[model samples]
Target chain A: MHYPNGKKNDQTQKTLANVSKSHAFSNRGMTLEEDINAANAFYRDTGKASIHKKPTPIQVVNVHYPKRSAAVITEGYFKQPSTTDYNGIYHGRHIDFEAKETKNKTRFPLANIHEHQIRHMKSIINHGGICFLIIRFSAHGETFYMPAETLFRYWDDQINGGKKSIRYETIANEGHIVPFHYQARVHYLAIIDKLYF
Target chain B: MHYPNGKKNDQTQKTLANVSKSHAFSNRGMTLEEDINAANAFYRDTGKASIHKKPTPIQVVNVHYPKRSAAVITEGYFKQPSTTDYNGIYHGRHIDFEAKETKNKTRFPLANIHEHQIRHMKSIINHGGICFLIIRFSAHGETFYMPAETLFRYWDDQINGGKKSIRYETIANEGHIVPFHYQARVHYLAIIDKLYF
Candidate 1:
C-alpha cells in the first residue's frame, strides 16, 4: 500500500528499521512519539505537567455498524491539523509545541513544518502562552528544545531568501539540548524550566 | 438512515428545528456548535482569545489511494476522546471546556458526559487550568457555563449513588447564564471574565 505522500508500506517499514538501527533506542527501540508519550505520562503521574498529544484528525465519510459490534468508519480522509500536536497547562501557563524528527546529519529542514503550524505557533506566542518546537536529529541521536521565538527568526530568514535549513551548529547554540532520562525519556520540560521560568 | 444511537437523521433534523424554534438562534437558526465556532473565530480575529474545538478523533483501519485525488480511508472507528472538546490559551491561562446540549426539559442527564471526561476535567483543574462545561438547554432557550469545580460536585454525587441527573433549578442557581451577542455569538468568555478574572 502506498500513502498519499507516495511512501509505500515497505518504505515505512525500512525507515522504522533504519531508525532502530541508527538511533539510541536501547530499550526495545522506542520511537520518538513513544518517548514523548512516556515523558508526558511520567509528568502527569508525578503532577509535574499536564500535556497530551492530540489525536490525528480524520474526516470520516462513511460508517458501517455490525449488529453486535462497535460502529466501523468505512470511508474517511486525514485532515490537516490546525494547531500543534501537543498542548496543555504547565505551571498555570498554556504550553504549546510541535515535535519532529529528521535523519539528516548536518541540518534540519524548515520544510518539515507546515505553514499553518508556524501561524499557529505565532498565535500562541502572541497570546502569552509558551510556544516551542522539539526537534530530534536521529542521525546524531540528539534532541533539542527550540523556543518559538528562535524558530520565528529562522522562519522569517527563510522568507527573506536565506538558508532553507537550519545548520546543526545553529540549533546547538540557540536550542537547549534535551536530556533523555530512563523514566522521563524526553526531558524537554527541564529545558522549559530553565528557559521560561 | 438511523445512527447506531437509534436516532434517525430525520429525527435529528426535527430536533434541530425544535432547537431553532425554542432556543435563541437569532442568526438563521445556527446550532450550538456553529455558535461556539463563530465565537472562537471572532475571538481569534480580534485577538481577544485563542481557543479551538479539537477535531473529532477517528481511528483509521484501512485506506485506499486512487490514481489521482486524495487518499481515502476505507475503514475506521470513532475513538473516544481523552480530553475535553475545546481548549486553548486565554489571558495566558490554559482554557479547557466541553460543550453539550440537551432537549430534555427538567433535568440534564449525567450520561451526556463520559466518565473519562470527568476524570480529564479533574486533571485540568488539578494542573491549575481553567475548565468548565457549556451546556445548552434547547427546550428552555437557555445556556449556562458551569465551572469544573461545580461539575465535579455533581459528578461525585452521582458516583456516590446520588441523583443521576442535575435539576434545571440547580444549574440556574449555580451556573452563570451565557448571554447571546451579535458578533461574539455565545459570549461564554464574558462569564469566564467575571468568574475567573
Candidate 2:
C-alpha cells in the first residue's frame, strides 16, 4: 500500500504535526471567537439582547466543602450539548444559534459540524425560529452569517449526492459577510435586521 | 408589640407559608410542570414547536465514574437563572416566554417574579422578538397568555405608585387564555397565531 510522504512506519510525528496545525493560529491578537463573545457580553449588559453562552455541563461525583461559603469541585465529567452555543430572546423573538471558527481557507468541511447540531437546527427551523451558523475563517479574517434555511438546503443536497462540503466560494456567494464594528464586533444583529426584520 | 394572627417572629410561619404558597398546587396527580414537560416532548416528536425547559443549572463540585458508562454526581449546588423558564423558536419567529403558575385566585403577586427576569424580558422585547408569559392559575384550571409588553407596563406602574400586583381582573381583561389541546397541551402557539400572525 502507498502512503503520503509525511506518513512513515512511526505515525507519531505526522499525528503531532496535524494536531499542532489545528491548534496554531496566524492571527496576531484576539481571535474572532473572543471578539464575538465580547460583543455578545456587551449586547447583554446594555439590555440590547439577552443572549448567553450555555455553561459547559459537567457531571459531579464528589465535592469538598471545607467551609460554609466555599465548595470545591473534586471530580467531574463533561457532557455533550443538546442545543446550540447561544440562545435567548431578541426583539421579543426566540434567538438560537451556534458559532464556529475554521482555519481552512478553501472549504469549510462538513466534518467540523456534528450530526446532532444539524438535527437540532432542523427542529428549530421547523418550529418557526431563525437559526444559523456564524462561520469565521481565521486564515482570511472573514466572517459569514449563514442562515439555517440556506444551510438546510445544502445539507439536504449532500444527502442526494451533491457537494459533500461547503466551499469558501459558495459561502461567499450565499452567506452574508458579517461586518465588524467597535461595540458589536461581529455585528450579527445588523444582518439579523436585514434578514428577519 | 403586637403581631398579626398571634405570630411575633419576623421569619414566622406566616412568612414561610407565603413563600411556599406561590409554588403550591392543589392537584395531586403528576405535577402540572411534569405534565407540561411530557406534552412538550410529545409535541417535538410529532413535528410541532421545538420548546424545551432549560436544564436546571448546577455547579458541580465532584463526579465519579465507577464504570466506563456509568457516571455519578456526588456534589452540586443550584444556580439562579439569568433568563426565563422556557425559550425556543416557533414558526419562523423567535419565541421567548416564561411559564409561571400561581395559586392565588384573585391576584398574581409581584413577588412571584424576579427582577433580573423582568429586565431580561424587557431586552427581548426591545429587539423585536415575541415575548410573553404563560400564567396558569391552577385553582381555576385556567392559563393566560400575558404579553411581556403589558407585563412590563404593569411592572413599571407598580414601581411608580400603581397596584402592587396584577389583579386577576386585569389579567382577564388584557391577557388571552391559552386553550388546552390534546396534542399541544399548552396550545400557546395558537395564542401566538392570534396575537402575532
Against the hidden reference, what TM-scores do the models get?
Answer: 0.86, 0.69
For residues B1-197, write the lDDT of model 2, one tens digit per residue.
21222422343455445534655573433345654676677767887677776765665433445644434455455467778867676665666788888778999988778888898787777777788988888888788899999999989998899888899989999999877777666678788899888
Runs in model 1 with CA error above 4 Å?
A1-28, B1-28
What DockQ does predicted model 1 obtain? 0.39
Candidate 2 displacement at residue B39 in angstroms: 3.9
Fnat: each model in turn: 0.70, 0.36
**What's the CA RMSD for each of the models?**
7.2, 13.7
B16-107 per-residue lDDT for model 1 (tens digits): 56646776443346668888999999999898898998888765555677765567777666777888999999888899999988888899
- lDDT score for candidate 1 against the true structure: 0.84
Docking class of 2: incorrect
Clashes of 1: 1
